[model samples]
Target: MDDKDRELMDRYVYQVVRRLPKDQRDDVSMELKELIGDMAEEKGSVREALVALGDPAEFAKKYAGESRYLIGPLYIDTYWKVLKIALMCVLIAVFSITLAQGIIERYEPGLFTDLGSIIGFFTHIFSTTLSSTISSALGVFATVTIVFMVMEHYKVDLDEGKNVVWTIDDLSKKEPGSKANVTGMSAEWTPDRLTPVPGKKAMLPRGDSIADIVFSVIFGAILIFTPYILGVVWFIEDDEIGKGVMTIPIFNLDKWNLILPVFLISLLAGLTDAILRVIIGRYNLKVMVSSIVSGFIQIVCWIIALKVLPIWNPNFGNELRRFIDSEFGAMDFATYFDPVRFSNIILVLAIFGLAVEMIVTVVRTLRYGLDEGKAR
Candidate 1:
């Protein structure tokens, strides 16, 4: 063979064998090279032989099976369907809000008058859109995964009794000239009805999956990011503790250093779910376990923030009083809005929510490890 043919054959072999596991690579590479050489002899050219073998990636897939698993066999298909829908909804909602806010916030006296300003304006819009999309997608992924994890754990009958028992009599009826078509529409056996024997694949409807994913992402994002945003607002204009450029928002918690990391851990957990959803596309045993860890982290953080640590900034009270006297606001308004009382109410609600989530998650791990429910 010419040097060029040898080089081309080597490249093709490398591409295919590189995707195999390390243990299998050497054996597969030798086998593929010998097979390709034989095919090239028949095909008359190395290029033609490689083309007949088809795409390197596809050939690798045929040999390799699933190279990477985000969701396991039981959970991936549903995860994928749900994720696509959630992503679509998130994209629409995020871009709409981001575009509107970007235009409103970045408008300036000379923004449209110069080339530089126009470039900056578009850049701002693009950055905001991208960030919002990523944030929303992550939020959606976490929500879908957690919900599916719970459902998987419980072995919720996704498609209850989708398959019916078959009989030898039915098979015998399909023999030549037996014609056992039973739909009444068929000219064979005029059975009143027909039931399809469902396959093992989960029967989750795409629309339902999509809706579930969209809702989960939106709600989860709100819960995770609200505190982060508040913390950011608290530190935006002031480097000092307990001080901000604007009047301290009544909703902000004090001691950012203490609360921030806890919040980040929880957020990262949600992000883990998002990445898994994108990778695996289903709720399974592994996803459920990961979620259990994420949930526990959030519950601990919430418990501390609610029952032990102070959630509202004490500085907000001071700021409110100052604002009241400076503006037409009532002086007594600040006194009426008690941060302690406000925090207690929030604590009660948060704990209750966490308790519900914990129960469902724990129950799921106990029940379904990795069983493929009739409905994925």
Candidate 2:
């Protein structure tokens, strides 16, 4: 095959094998490449050869087995993986907040003497736990299912397929150190992969990178859109604040007027990066570019948090004062939650964490890209 045909074949193989199961990827890719090459040789055109194979997406389904399922075989693993993560996040956030509130507000060790009190106490506990756990789990299921459904519908590549391809050297029997020398289904099988040497465009996803993409998109969505849903659940009402539970939504959208626009732009950029990473299943130039944009946005958020964004609610200021006084008699604890100082401290932490992460990610990804970019 000429350089053009070889390049076309490489792209075609990538499209096919990336959607297949990892264990079957190498074998399928080699077989597909061989089939395509033979067709191209006979058809006298690489384009015609690919056309004969049909749409790469449809061709992938042939190897994938055309099962009539909502989520195909290719994405079941990812679906479960994402579902578990989302569920955990939701549960942890919901339960932690509610449980903390419940424990603090209703920490009565004395046995309930009256049947009415006993019934009421148990009912409250059951209601609180049931509401928090079930609601949060449902929300998570919806988010995870929606994301997976979109992926399945679009047939987004999620690294289920192997990242190997056939090379001309496979024709040579005794090529020392050649990747084709690797064995499959044998004692000599070294992962049974003939990994295509990394090139300018060859950026395979690392486990960490893919995970980062998944959680970032998931949590970012939750953070931006459903801020009200995730917060400190407060049931203990201060006499000053009046009767009823008060939720201190630290990331509340109602108060996130200015910060919302800027923060969401950053969030959206991160979400885009994550989705693109799933599609490419790698850290490439585009991914790196997105990271750079996201990093800058994170920095801006930190700055805003420090300068303008109130970490604590203004509405809660007077209530907090009364609550503190009631909980601990005659103790002035206003400075403990000085919004400016607290937010700045939080910003400091955020900036440091994001800076370190960005630096490490950029360096690792850039080195990989540079290594791939070397003249072959």
**RMSD in angstroms, candidate 2?**
15.9
Put down candidate 2 lDDT per residue, 88-137, tens digits, no spaces. 64576566566645554554444366787678776777689779789879
Q: TM-score for every candidate vs. truth?
A: 0.45, 0.47
lDDT of 1 by residue, 307-366 (tens): 675566767666656666655566684456676677678767866775675465456544
Clashes of each: 7, 0
How much is the lDDT of residue 110 in candidate 1?
A: 45
RMSD of each: 12.9, 15.9
Deviation (Å) of 367 in candidate 2: 5.0
